[model samples]
Target chain A: EAGVAQSPRYKIIEKRQSVAFWCNPISGHATLYWYQQILGQGPKLLIQFQNNGVVDDSQLPKDRFSAERLKGVDSTLKIQPAKLEDSAVYLCASSLGTGNGYTFGSGTRLTVV
Target chain B: AQSVTQPDIHITVSEGASLELRCNYSYGATPYLFWYVQSPGQGLQLLLKYFSGDTLVQGIKGFEAEFKRSQSSFNLRKPSVHWSDAAEYFCAVGEGGNTPLVFGKGTRLSVIA
Candidate 1:
């Protein structure tokens, strides 16, 4: 099966700039997630969606980050006025059912200078 | 709250030797546990997961994980180490079904020939 798809693979932006990352989850999967992975650390959840509805987003930097899964399919994560600490890999994952193992995309590496 | 911990920041092992990566989770109840591997410039891949059944669960790429409820641990192990097995390993826990996972800081493995 085709895996979750992510775009850009890499990005570089100055502080206070804006950036967006796109993701397409595996077909038939309804649960989608966005995570940020900093250097020397593990990926941290930014948001989660169950069929276009957000299930959780407690860790998201609401003032600078936003995400959407408009059609319950493709999703996008946007960061406005990026901070230097925002530099990290953005990972996208999808699960067929609740609590199932996720299939992930290659991820987009963002560097905020 | 659900949390995961990886005690080792990094480890080096010789080829053909045994390998082990420790993981411990804290949760109020029995949680779904998983092990994932991340290669440089790539995304996370499922190594194994334990939701129920036998404590020892095998995964792809010659990896396995054991869930110990008594210790609140789900450690990954490989009987024989390989150069290609060197990568960042993460342990995660979730409530299952529309819940997001809590991940550890990760442990980097280096396999020496």
Candidate 2:
């Protein structure tokens, strides 16, 4: 099976700039997730979508980070006015459903200068 | 709220030696557990998962994990460490449907000959 796909293996932008990352989940998967992994830290859940409808975004910084999984297939995560602290690897993952392990994409590495 | 903890930040072992990565999770209900491995500049790959039925679950690359309810732990084990096994390992917990997985900080394993 094809793995989850992500675009822009790496990105570099100045602080306060805007950046976007794209993700394509495995075929037929119903759940998509976005996570931010900082250096020396665990990956934190940024948002979750269950077939286009948001299931969770409480941890997302709504003022700066936004995510959408339109048509319940592909997802995009955007960080507007990106902070210096926003420099990290953004990972996308998908699963068949509950009780199954997730398949992760190669992630987008963002560097804010 | 759900959280995961990987007590070891890094570990080094001689090649062909046994290895163990500890993971502890906090959740109220019956929890779904997972172990993932990430090489540098790469995405996460599922090592194994525990939903139910068996306490010990085997995964790819000769990895296995044991889930202990009383310990609130799911520790990954490998009988013979190889140089390729040097990577970061993460432990995660998730609820069934809508909830996203909560990940640990990850343990970095270094293999020496």
Return the top candidate by TM-score.
1
Q: Score the docking of each candidate (DockQ).
A: 0.82, 0.79
TM-score of each: 0.98, 0.97
Native contacts present in each candidate (fraction)? 0.81, 0.76
For residues B1-113, could you state the per-residue lDDT of candidate 1 as single tens digits? Answer: 99999999999999999999999999988889999999999999998888989999999988989999999999999999999999999999998877888899999999999
Model 2 lDDT on a 0 to 1 scale:
0.93
Question: What tens digits encode model 2's per-residue C-alpha lDDT throughout A50-103?
Answer: 899998899999999999989999999999999999999999999887578789
Model 1 / residue B82 / CA error / Å: 0.6
lDDT for B93 (candidate 1): 94
lDDT of 2 by residue, B17-107 (tens): 9999999999988899989999999999988888888899999999999999999999999999999999999999988765688899999
Q: Can you list the residue pairs that collide in candidate 2? A: none
